[model samples]
Target: MASDAPADSVPALPDPVSRARLVDAVRFDRDGLVACIAQQHDTGEVLMMAWMNRTALEETLATGRVTYWSRSRAALWRKGETSGQVQRLIDLRLDCDGDTLLALVDQTGVACHTGRRSCFYRAMRGDALVALTEPEADPAELYGR
Candidate 1:
């Protein structure tokens, strides 16, 4: 006898919660933003860290494109909007306390505005900061300077 479930039927994905629900789940900072850390899904490399407001988190979930709140610009920043380094969301994970978020993404190009693969290219060695990796592409070429 065949099973009742259809072969082509995909498992029901959890429905997205409302903005109010999300707000309740996450504990935002005094500025009403949470720290979102982006990591390369396949390589397990940390790409960068950014801040996200309620709207940015909602938009990211709805659009599958990483959106961040730019503290410097005081506005929503869509990844790859200016540069070609887009981040496609693979998964989103909330921390135990729900104060932080981890975004697993497929990075298209360099994740750093400095044209590096990751923003964390500096390491502490012998009480001195050491550069881990060099820029893959020139910032001028990537940003059209």
Candidate 2:
């Protein structure tokens, strides 16, 4: 927790840099990766949740595109590279806790690997959980083996 210093104790910058500053300003795990939540800017729909390391974060900000660290592949992946359903970052924001990221994006086509418009297309009604939409396209067609 930060100390309750004077209201203007620390000035705010539209953007931040420096290792120590980034460490103190943003919260990240020991692995240098932070949990990122992607949402549709216009619809307010949660598209996906993924991890972003410092490199990925910087790359996203620098390129105006969303890049994420692929946990399974152990590599950096540009979203929609194969599917053509790319997420164009409208804004990148941090929560008060600084532990999580909220990405406001303008998404094209489907945003889920399952070929859904959004990754979270399931609804919980009482004890029943139901899928909302059919797959827009086959996963294999978007991402090959």
- Which has the greatest lDDT? 1
Worst 10 residues of 2 by lDDT: 1-10
Task: List the candidates' TM-scores in order.
Answer: 0.84, 0.78
Give the C-alpha miss distance for residue 70 in model 2, angstroms: 0.8
Q: For residues 1-145, write the lDDT of model 1, one tens digit per residue.
A: 1111121211122346553465569889999999999999999999999999999988777666788999999999988777877787777788999999998887877999989999999999899999989999898987899
User: Model 1 off-target regions past 4 Å?
Assistant: 1-23
The true-versus-predicted C-alpha distance at residue 93 of model 2, in Å, is 0.8
Q: Which stretches of candidate 2 lie over 4 Å from their true place?
A: 1-24
Against the reference, the lDDT scores of all candidates come to 0.81, 0.75
Worst 10 residues of 1 by lDDT: 1-10
lDDT of 2 by residue, 26-77 (tens): 6888988899999999889898999998788876665556779998999998
Candidate 1 root-mean-square deviation in Å:
8.0
lDDT of model 1, residue 57: 86
